[model samples]
Structure formats: structure tokens, C-alpha cells
Target: MDGLHSQQNVDLEEFRRRVQQGNDPHGPVRETLSRLGDRWTPLILMILRTGIMRYTQLLKEINSMADSPVSQRILTLKLRACERDGFIQRTVIPTVPPQVEYGLTDLGQAMVQELNRLIGWLEVHEVQINACRAEYDAH
Candidate 1:
């Protein structure tokens, strides 16, 4: 079993080296990450994870965060990008006053489980992460 695992690891390393050397076996994955890794995308995704929300609500919620208050221009750009990437759906309500709401698409909802897992991991390891940061700063 250990020998099999070692062989698997070697194969993975070789694959990674080949990919790094411009033999991209996974070009689509790289492209997707490149498209989605903008500054505001993750924050928008995180906020929408709660549920569907109106545009103003999202803006206010983002603004309330001290560490990352997304500018209106950047938020507009990110939302448009997400829409183009099929990560989210935007709806406009027809009424005396128009209302706009945003929610995750099917593909975006698929990410929630993984996102939750990541958040759980962060919560579990937060103490260690903070300790490491403090130790590094003190050095």
C-alpha cells in the first residue's frame, strides 16, 4: 500500500512538473481560476452564500466590513464578471420602483458545499493560524 501511494505521489509530481513546463494538461482549470480570482469575487460569493440579496443590501453588507469595503465601481465590475462567468444570476423586478436581486446560479450553488468545508477548516484551525501570525510578527 505504501509503495502504491509513493508511486502515485511520484506520478503526481511528474504531472505537476510537466504542467509547469508549459505542458498544460489542465488548461481549463487554470483559465477558470484566472477568471474567478479577482479581488471582489470571493467576497461577493461569500456574502451571497447566505441567500439571495438585493443590490443595495449587498453593497451595504460589503461596506460594513472594515477589512474589505468594496467600491461601487469594483463591485459593478465583479458582479458583471460573475454574471458573464455563469457563477451568479441577476434579476430585475418590474414595479413602480425597480428592484434588483442577485443569487447564485446552479454552478455557484455547487460551490457552497466546498466553501462551507473551507470555512469549517478555517474555523477549526483559526487558533493555530493566529498563533503562527503572531509568532512570525514577533520574530
Candidate 2:
């Protein structure tokens, strides 16, 4: 029992080192996950996946579909954060009005694809999940 416990502790420590250490590859993934988990970013990325979109266009589409619309200030902040994180590319067109557009970068597209897979899984298991939640809540 002691030997098994010692091995489990070693494994747990290694897990922490890989995930928590800056030099470890997993640390960056953890950081990116935290950023991507924000409220409006997933919606923004999903919209951008179709094609490049103007700021107002994307904002309108997102706000229309959401229960509580994202404010212009919040949307701008999330867009800047996404651009900074290399998840989206921003292009400014010098028209009479100076239009700005956003599109998913290669990295962003890849991430959206992965996120879709997770959403698909959730859709498939939603019934089971609800049942489990009900059971847990009853107890």
C-alpha cells in the first residue's frame, strides 16, 4: 500500500510540473484555454469562421443570437484579446469610413474545429447529462 501511494504521489507531482511549469508545453495550452473560455470569444470565433466580417456585422450577428447582447466595449476588448492571442487576424480597410474586418487565423480555425467536436459530444450526451444532474440533485 505504501509503495502504491508513493507512486501515485510521484505521478501527481509530474502532472503538476508538466501543467504548471512555464517551460512545459502544457502550460501555454492551459493559458490559452483560460482565455478562450471567456463569454463572447467562442461566439466571435464561430462567426468569424464563416468568412471575414466587419466589426458591426459581427457584433450585430452575435448580439442578435445571444440572450444578453454584448456591449460594444466588451466586444472590442474581446476582439483585441483574440487578436493578441493569435486566434484572429484584424484588417483595417482605409475606405471613406475606414472599415475594419476580422477573420480567423489558421490557429483560430483549428481551435474552432476542435471546439465544434466538443460541442458535438455534448449534444450527443445531453440527455444522459441531464439525467445524471437530476439524480445528483435529488440526493
Candidate 3:
């Protein structure tokens, strides 16, 4: 029991050390994740990858992906955060009805590449991941 407790403490300390070392050598990676690591941010980025899109267009794209889609309010909030983090740009064109468009910035383009790489890795390993989950759950 004592050995097990000591091993747990060592494991926890290693975890804490890693988390505390955030952003020193990994500013870009950490920043990107911080900006886009949300339920809807990656989806929004993926949608905008094609080209600029209107608000309703983005909403529709997301809605088509899932049955219970993201709410307008949540999408708005995520967009604002992405804009603030320099991942995206929101342009409002002057018109009678006002045309608003959202698109990715250079930073966002880079983020998209990273995200695509992550998606690729997941696609390759999804079966293994699901099998691991099933094995764990069976125990």
C-alpha cells in the first residue's frame, strides 16, 4: 500500500510539472489549442477553410453536421473568441441589410493545417482507439 501511494504521488508530480511547463517552448501550440480547443471552434475553422462565409451559412454548415447542433449564441461566442485570438477575422460590409462575413487569417490557416493533421491521425487510429476504450470498459 505504501509503495502504491508513493508511485501515485510521483505520477501526480510528473503530471503537474508537465502542465506547469505550458507555453515556454510551446507558445504557438499552446496558443492555438487555447484559442480553438472548444466544441465548435475547430468545426468553424473547418467550415471557413473553403472560403469566407456568412453567419447564416456557417450556422447551417454546423447544423447539417449534427442533429443537436450548436446554438447561435454559442457560435457567436466562439467566433468572437477566435477573432480576439487572431485566428479569424469578422468583416461587416456596409449595406442596407449589412453583410457580415467570417474568414480565416494566416494564423488560422496554419491552425487548420495542424487541425487537419490531428484529424488525419485520429482517422488512422480511430479503430484502435475504440477497441482500447472497449477493452478498458470491459474491465
Winner by lDDT: 2
Query: Taking the tens digit of each residue's C-alpha lDDT, what string does model 2 give over 18-88?
Result: 66664554456666777678888889988899999999999999989899999999999999988988999
In the range 59-108, model 1's lDDT, one tens digit per residue, is 99888863868777888888887787778899999977999999998887
By TM-score, the best candidate is: 2
> How far is 136's C-alpha from truth in model 2 (Å)?
1.2
User: Local distance difference test, per candidate?
Assistant: 0.81, 0.90, 0.88
* Model 3: pairs clashing at backbone N, Cα or C within 3 Å: none
Question: In candidate 1, how many Å is residue 120 off?
Answer: 1.1
What's the TM-score of every candidate structure?
0.71, 0.83, 0.77
Which is better, 1 or 3, measured by lDDT? 3
For candidate 3, the per-residue lDDT at 70 reads 93
Could you tell me which 10 consecutive residues in candidate 2 have the lowest summed lDDT? 22-31
Which digits, one per residue and each the tens of the lDDT, describe model 3 over residues 1-139?
9999999999999888767766465465465667566678889999999999999999999999855889989999999988977889999999989999999999899989999999999999999999999999999
Better of 1 and 3 by TM-score: 3
RMSD of each: 3.9, 3.8, 6.5
Cα-based lDDT at residue 109, candidate 3: 94
Rank all candidate structures by their lDDT, best first, as comma-separated numbers.
Answer: 2, 3, 1
Q: Which residue pairs come into collision in candidate 1?
A: none
Off by over 4 Å in 2: 1-14, 22-27
